[model samples]
Target: MSLRDRLKETRAKASDGFRGGKLMSSIFRPGSPFRKGYVDSPRNRSYVVMNNVLYHLHPVKVKRHGVRLSYTLCLGGLSFFLFIVLTITGIWLMFYFRPTELAYVDIQNLQTTIAFGSLVRNMHRWGAHLMVLVVFLHMSRVFYHGAYKAPREFNWVIGVILLLLTLLLSFTGYLLPWDQLAIWAVTVGGNMAGYVPVVGAQVKFGLFAGLEATTATLLRFYVLHVLFFPFIIVIFMAVHFWRVRKDGGISGPL
Candidate 1:
């Protein structure tokens, strides 16, 4: 037998299930419209076919009606918009401010000397606040809707973790300005860490790097706020959204 013929015979003999069994794999029917050639149009029908064939990660049919503006607008879309705004404004603010003892001084200089710098800082601050609010609302909406059921329970757990991370992100940023508000907020927050059982002292020491919120504390929080949290949140958010799509789109109230 030829090499190609031998290979085909080997595959045919191996297992019937190898053809994609009924019990396994959500297989689309061969020659169905979904599997057929695309409709030819003037603009890029070939490209559409290519994309559909190449990227089959997303489901062929999303429940378009199930995805409502009322459910998604403030919860998902607004929060994502605020995240984008924070990322842009934060990067712009970075050009002028150093994450050092001079950090507060740089901010002061920006407010007094730099054009529209105060506005930039205010927008970042307010956006941070709004992100928190919207995230909380999102969580509540998901919870009330019973979206945590069955296959989506794990993703709901991830969403809860992301919520905590958002709060941590806000708390870390709170210390960056080094104003009285920032100082006292970190002090109180650090003290709360010390209130935890068993390894509380260790956690508090690690957070503050000794007795007080020193230069070390400022630098730690800065690194976390600007660098660490953003990276972590981005990854988690991507997973969260993917899982949403996977769990058959966002759930409606039970």
Candidate 2:
């Protein structure tokens, strides 16, 4: 057997012999020194993973210098980091902004009133665009790497759903400014939804909450942008992260 396999066997045997409450304590305690630096420690094992069945998801020993640049650059982590940046900047902008009839003028005043508000807004806007582009590229990388095979297929589907949700989030947020571009963009988007054959009109009405782009439409988009999609995206992201572990730690090229 390999040295690492033998070592894991020895550790398992040793851990299995611990008696009393001490056994369970050591098994469950993440900070237990006995478990630290050991590969088979319960805290370090894949037992907690809920998706798929692949257990060799983590390296027994990861080399610090072996990580590939393409994986780091094109993986979804960069997109996530950009999303975080946008979230922080969006929150900051919210302090001096409102999402109503004067939203556009308020945005204009923010550019002039709040210190660095214009920079913050620009960062938020550009970061959002970059995030969308990065997410699409990340999915492409995953696909090209054959990372979505077997146990990872479900996670791949989830990733696709997350991508769609991310696009929806960006679209909804576009309307909160109440600008001409925002209005027409949403109007065109709603009209597209309205072209859903027999249910097109109903779909459009549901999205706008009326026959026209009234206060209800703005309020609906505002709530969706600020609340609903964020919560759903965060949940799916959590699932995605967990699935990464379950799918054998981001599949390598065949």
Off by over 4 Å in 1: 1-61
lDDT tens digits by residue: candidate 1, 1-254: 89999999888655444445553224443322233332455333334433454334344444664556776564776787799999999998888988778988999998999989999999999999999999999888877777789889999898898889889999999998888899899999999999899999999999998877987999899899899999999999889878988787757644
TM-score of 1: 0.75
| Candidate 2 structure quality by residue, lDDT tens digits, 27-140 | 544433344233555555433332213322344443343266756564587887887898899888878767677788888988898889889989988888788888999898
- The CA lDDT at 15 in model 1 is 48
Candidate 2: 10-residue stretch with minimal lDDT: 48-57
Model 2 spans > 4 angstroms off: 1-66, 72-74
In Å, residue 236's CA in model 1 sits off its true spot by 1.0
Cα deviation in Å at residue 239, candidate 2? 0.1
User: What is each predicted model's overall lDDT from 0 to 1?
Assistant: 0.80, 0.77
Superposed by TM-score, candidate 2 places the C-alpha of residue 72 at a distance from the truth, in angstroms, of 4.6
- Candidate 1, residue 22: CA error in Å? 46
Model 2, residue 11: what's the lDDT?
A: 85
TM-score for each predicted model, relative to the true structure: 0.75, 0.74
